[model samples]
Target: MYTLLIADDERAIREGISRSVSWSDIGIGRVLLAANGKEAYDIIMKERPDIVLTDIIMPVYTGIELVEKVKDTMPQVQFIILSGYNDFAYAQKAIQNEVKQYLLKPCDAESIRKSVQKAVSRIRDIEKKEQFIASMKENVEKLFPQAKEQFFRDLVHGSPNTQNIEAYKELFNVHDGPYRMLLFRIDDNDYVKLLTLKSLVERNFGEENVTFCIIINTAVVLLTTLTGFHELSGLVEKTQKQCYANFNIEATVAVSSEGCISNAAQMYKEIRDIIRFEFYLGEGRIITKDDISVFRNDYSLDTGIQTEELSAAIRTGNIDSVKSITNCVFNAYRMKGYDINRIRACGIELFIIVLKHCEDCEINAWIKNITRINECNTASEIKQFILDFAVKLAERTYQSVISSQNRVIEKVIRYVHENLDDENLSLQHIASDILYLNVDYLGKLFKKETGMRFSQYLLKVRMEKAKELIKASSGDIKVYEIANATGFSNNPSYFTQVFKKYTGCVPKEFRETGKQEEKDSGWLPL
Candidate 1:
């Protein structure tokens, strides 16, 4: 809605115009009245009405004077001059002040309304242009970040859109520079913290000198016109300390040497290469070109020999040996300054070698999963990937060998062999309390594999052990001693009965004669 102001020395004329104008039809919601030019100027200044109608000659200030005062300050405000005299000078002054509407005194109500309708139309047009400009600005703000990231990416990749670096310099407001690039490898998943880290850097260095972009997981900061390396380092130190203390996140920054904006690609590459050293050097510290240059060495690894040794360790099921060999391989890669691709290739080769040695279908399935290897972007992740594969393969390989030899049956047999002297040793005890398996299922499986029920196997094993003890004693060991040695500590009479039933003679006869009728080992009575 628009507002209008009417000023006339004659009160009746002012009232008549204000009351008679159908202001709502003209889109004027509020109509104000002023008796003279001074009052009109005061009301205009306070209310900022869209249109002002004033008599040409008045007290305190003339209509021409009021228009002159407001024309420059509020050019949007439209003015209409009313006069009693048909004078050329007044009209000329009004024209000079850019007042387009001039209404003679005693003008009809319809004429006034028509003028106001035109003013409202002009006001609507201005509002429409302003709204359009505001929308454009909002869209520009939304797209600014994407454009900025792409530009920085181009600079880093040496594919800047324009060879005229000066154009970019002007466009991004990058000042004269002996610029240095810092790549921040932030260990954070929180999106807000990335922005906070950027803000912290900008605060440490002035905002104008810093251009920041996030490329993948790293944040690229371009610092222009730094005072010195030490000062930059101090600012970086502050930023790191504040970031951890405030956000509980660590950021490792890689700093590049001094260079110009034109050399930004090289500077960026220098930091980009060094930033990967964080996996070896650890996080939350700054890595400079000088620091990374020391890591390159003449150390070399024999990939084929290392692969063989690693596979052998997995086959032997020695996890410690596997881990030691794996660590040595990664350390060699680091010392030799292998790139990420070479490291990943080494990992894949090691994985494939181990998988080839594993006969277990499950291990084969696990070793064939190359997604984890491809997902590794750093030396640490790659090392961990291979180490995890090594450990799993070793465990699975060991389990496979045991399973092929009938692990459950072997475990039961070993237990029986070791504890034949214990009266409490039984398959039910072993299954229910020791190995946590159901007794019935264990019995069925054991008999299926060993071709004898658990009780029959137990009796045969005890009888065999008793005969060995009797023979080894050369008839000097007593009957009770023989029984106690084979899980019958108190019942020597029952031991004698079973001994005679199995060997067709008593323990004493077996010890002295070393011979028996050997009727199916006489072992199936139980």
Candidate 2:
């Protein structure tokens, strides 16, 4: 909907035009009346109406003067001139003011409506153009982040088009001078916080001087035309302090060696290496290549013994022993004043051992734990990481042992059930001949698993089978046949004695009774 303003010194003419024009039919939802040119100008300035109709001559200000005053700021507003005189001078002045329509003083409602229709058409066209521009701007805003990230990725990988370097600098509005890349590895891996930090940095350093991009998990800041290392360092420090103050996140920043736009890829690589070294340098600190140059000694530590002992304790599920070993190793490094790289190397070795152990035990979901290990930045953090890894490793190992024991026990029980009728199905035969296990150890394991001696279990199995055969036979099979069928050899009397002891009934009596009611009653017949 559009607003229309009518200005005429005559009140009746203004009200007649406003009432008879049917503004809604002409696509004007509002019709504002202004008594004179000055009132109309005030209304236009305040409301910014879509269409204006004014007489060429009025009391406070002339219509030409109003149009001239507001044409620059209200270029989108459409205008129509109503004049008592049809002189060439008035027509020429209306043309100069770019009025959309001109009408004589005695014009009827039809002429005014036609003029408003034309003004509405022009407003619609203007609105459509504005909408298209806004849509294009929105699309560009959405694509900018992705484009920036891709550009940084290509630059860092040394894959950006060499021919387009100057074009890119101009397009991105980056100055051509010495640049430095600062790579930040945030400990929390919070992209939102990283973005906030990026905004803070852009605000501290001018937005034109800095460009922020996130490559994989790290946030990259390219400082354009940075004056000196000290200035870059100061900016980084300010960013860190602000980030902590605002978001409570700790970030470690690694600055690259100075270079120009063409050297961005190489500088990125250098700074990236330093950022990776942050695993040892700890968090919430700014690092540079120069800071690492002093600690460039050939420092090496033999971690074989520590690794062995830690692995042994983990295998044994000894949490205390593992913690002791981990603390000792880290403390020793701390006392010896080992460089961060050496300490990191040791930490990596220890982590690999745990991972290998987990792999050996078929525990493959330790990626999150490994990530924590990689993020550790201090001796205490490293120690805690090792301890936590050891604890989980111990739990998984214990569960693995229990699972293996259950599987072995199930196999043993299945074997016993399948061979219940074999006469030579003793523990020795089952352990050594069939299952490939030591006889004595298998016997002890079976007893521990089933809470009974091997012989007792075998006797119980045989006696149960003898009773089943005897009852199912209905006297068709004799006692001797039952005994032999139940892996009891040729001893009918012995089978009866064993059945009597097990079920409190002789074999013949159990078969004749056709039920074991006396068994539940604890009846023992000699």
Candidate 3:
């Protein structure tokens, strides 16, 4: 639907056109009548009618002049010229004012309708084009930020593009000057909290001065000139405090050295590399180029004898030795400021070494400690876990070692008692044939466990068995039988010598003394 305005100096002409034309058929919703061009111009301004039909000659303003005034203000308003004279000048003036429809006077009702319809058609076309342009502009506005973010990311990671940098800056609305990259490493992985932190940082530093993207964590491409490079330290510190107080997060900021927009890739690389030092510097810190320069070249891990030393300590079940070696390893890493991954790997290596030496202990604690070690963000935390783990492992190993040595000594003693009649029962036979252990190691271990050498323990057991056999036997029991029964095969005299030395009497005399003692206490022996 469209609004149509009819204007003429003659009241009849204006009223006749409004009445004769079936305005609705011509897509005219309302027909406004103006007696002169001045009145029509006023109506056009006020009503903003879609189409205007006016005569060339009017009392106040000419139709041509009205067209000229309205066209500048509302180019979308289509104009139709009505002239009483067949004059080329009037038609020429209509054409000059961009009036598409020119109708001479005495035109019929059908002709006026056709001309108004043509104006309506032209108006519809103009509206469609305008609508398309508005829609396109709306979509572009929505996508503009995303495109700008991608451009910033490309500029940060890709090769330097100094050639068209100015045009790019204009396109992306980036201020031209020195730039720096700030990477925030958030301890928490909650994305919503991360975004909140980003918003907080952007608020502290104006949004236009920084472009942010979340890659692993938040990365900020700061326009140093816009933010004032000298003021960055104070702003970063303020943001850090806010992050702690508001978000309760430990966000460590790694800042690159001052650089141009062209070398943003270098700046990003520098900041990323600087962030890795947080493992040594501890978290929730503002690390800058100057802060890390001294240790930048000192990244090699000291993988010398520390691992071997720690392993040996754990094996020996020495808690103090284990702790000392653990301290040495961690101190070396802290001094060199090794890469965090390398340090983690070293920690894992020590964990494996501990696991290797462990037997019959709670393994889950060590496995959980591996995760704890990996999750530790700072050197001190990892060192503490390793130290505690090593110490506990040493204690467990010590208990296991003691329990195992007791069990082996018990087996050796049981074997000697079980095989005493063999007369070949010896520590060497027990170690090699029964227990399958090194003779020297078993000997020293036996003495340490029982306060007696294996051989001495064996002799004591044999002599005790001999005395028991002789005393428990009847008086008819032979000495040789008693000797053979007590592991002295076919050598009663030698057994007697050993038995006499053990009990201060020969075997026969010992038996006779026992009988005599029984006779003295009672009337007869059973």
- In model 2, which regions exceed 4 Å deviation? 9-12, 34-49, 57-60, 135-149, 159-163, 166-171, 184-213, 217-255, 272-526
* Alpha-carbon shift of residue 83 in model 1 (angstroms): 3.6
Each candidate structure's TM-score, on Cα atoms with residue i matched to residue i, is 0.51, 0.45, 0.56
Best by lDDT: 1
Q: What does the lDDT read for residue 395 in candidate 2?
A: 76
Model 2, 1-526: lDDT tens digits are: 8999999999998988899966777788898999988899999999989988898889888998989988999888898999999898988988888887889889888888998898899889888999999999999999977776676667777883545877776766656667778776665545677778767777778866665445454474655567487887788788888888887777789888778777877887787657655645678888888666644444333555887898888897777788888888888898888766667666765676676566523444564555665566776887787778788888777778777767776787787778776777888887888889898988888878888877777777777677678767758888778877777665678877778888777887887776765573332232
lDDT at 452, model 1: 91
When summed lDDT is taken over every stretch of 10 residues in candidate 1, the lowest stretch is: 293-302
Q: Cα lDDT of model 3 overall?
A: 0.76
Model 3, residue 105: C-alpha shift (Å): 2.9
- With a 3 Å backbone cut-off (N, CA, C), the pairs that clash in candidate 1 are none
Candidate with best TM-score: 3
Winner on lDDT (1 vs 2):
1
Candidate 1 lDDT (Cα, whole model)?
0.79
So what's the TM-score on candidate 3? 0.56
